[model samples]
Target: MKPKFITISDSIIKKIKSGELIPGDKIPSENELIKNYKISNTTARKTLLEIESKGWVRRIKGKGTFVLNRTATHQLVRTLGSIDSTRKGFNESLKAEGLTPKNIILEKTILNEGVSAAIVGRHVIIEGPVLKVHQLRYADDELMKDETRYISLTLCPKIDALSTEISYFKAYEQQYNLKINDIRQTLSADILEANSNKNHFGTTSNIAIFVLDSAVFADDGKVIEIEYSYYRGDKYKFAISAHPEYGHKSDD
Candidate 1:
């Protein structure tokens, strides 16, 4: 039999899936869960943590646990720039749409040379330690994307010691006196199995996801960082615009 906490959490998840509990709606408090389910304080807390871990809800300190819009649609307008620039653009867009934007650092570690070469590209030689950072991004309290960034520690020695919640570019400029010169990025898509990502994205199998790969360079032509990102397809729309002078002749 499943644990009591898991059973309780699943029941709440079902309500969220059924739309009986809409986004921003507060879930039962710890005391309420304990009284309603006859569970202990520890079990009640675990239940809340489990649901939050699955991206179905968010807990605000001193406030309350609230439902998140796991299926809300967001828009991404691609432009030529570094990851930091793209992040700033998205933050502004979310605000303009009346949504709150947040970035949560999930994990950070030092990448070995072998692992670094595989993800950061074989062509990029690893001269020093590489810092790998994993982050979850959200809009209006809804999870939107998972991002992984690999930074060259040799270029910015103090990066590994800083908090991942801060803007990387800003941190570099302020702490290391470095400025990003350019970035090369690529976009692709893949279908993700619902069962595999249900806990990560709170969705069923065979879901479409967008992937973005980027390499960042400094003004002196040295590579500074690399990024691999996954965006939920059902929750995001892409927009692109071009000028005739920058490309092909106009039809007119």
Candidate 2:
């Protein structure tokens, strides 16, 4: 036997599938649902929460819940130097509906010096005094994460003068005539308020999340930016693709 709330949710899902419910449409109010379905207020609220956790709708405080149209907006491509990537499983949810992703830049800044790399043999010529930029990206106003990047001053001399109105990629392309090519990435897990990120995000303490450190390269095989990003573990995930080498046998 199933719960009454699930039955109600199923009805709503069917409505969406049948075009009776449209994307971005506000769901029927709790009061209306109670009146029509003869369900309790608790049951209605719980059903909405479950739907939200399943990524079917977004609930905004002081605003009503909205049905999502996951589509092209959620598909994240896997590639090198791709600053525009999304966490795992989210793209699928987005594609399920029909929405295009929009990334907004929250902030940018400059720094005095640059940092060093851990790779051997790549150290000597890899050193350069750099410019640092900090940005908080979002998908349609929802907070995604904060990214701090160190850029080579040799390629972009006036990195400090970039306007807050544009994204770094846009600035680099339009202003400095630079395009990204390859990237090397490493990921690890950590808690909030532990190190440099704590000072940046300005949080007391929160759940654990993934820290992404990437070295971005330009089309000319030159290293351009080294970025460190922190994502909310509960909200984001990563995707990977595997390709076996030639003449390799399966371990299984």
By lDDT, the best candidate is 1
TM-score of 1: 0.57
Provide the overall lDDT of each model, using Cα atoms, as 2-decimal numbers. Answer: 0.69, 0.58
Candidate 2 has a TM-score of 0.48
TM-score list, all predictions: 0.57, 0.48
Q: Write the residue-wise lDDT of candidate 1 on 1-252 in tens digits.
A: 999999999999999888666555579999999999999999999999999999888887775787765543544333433243343444543443346889887788887572333322335444557888888888877788888888888888868888665667666666788766655556678877878743367675577888877666677767788778888887765433332112211111
**In model 2, how large is the Cα lDDT of residue 115?**
69
Q: Where is model 2 poorest over a 10-residue stretch in terms of lDDT? A: 243-252
Q: Per-residue lDDT of 24-82 in model 2, one digit per residue for the tens?
A: 55677788788888889999887787677777777756656767765433322232222
At residue 150, give the lDDT of candidate 2: 77
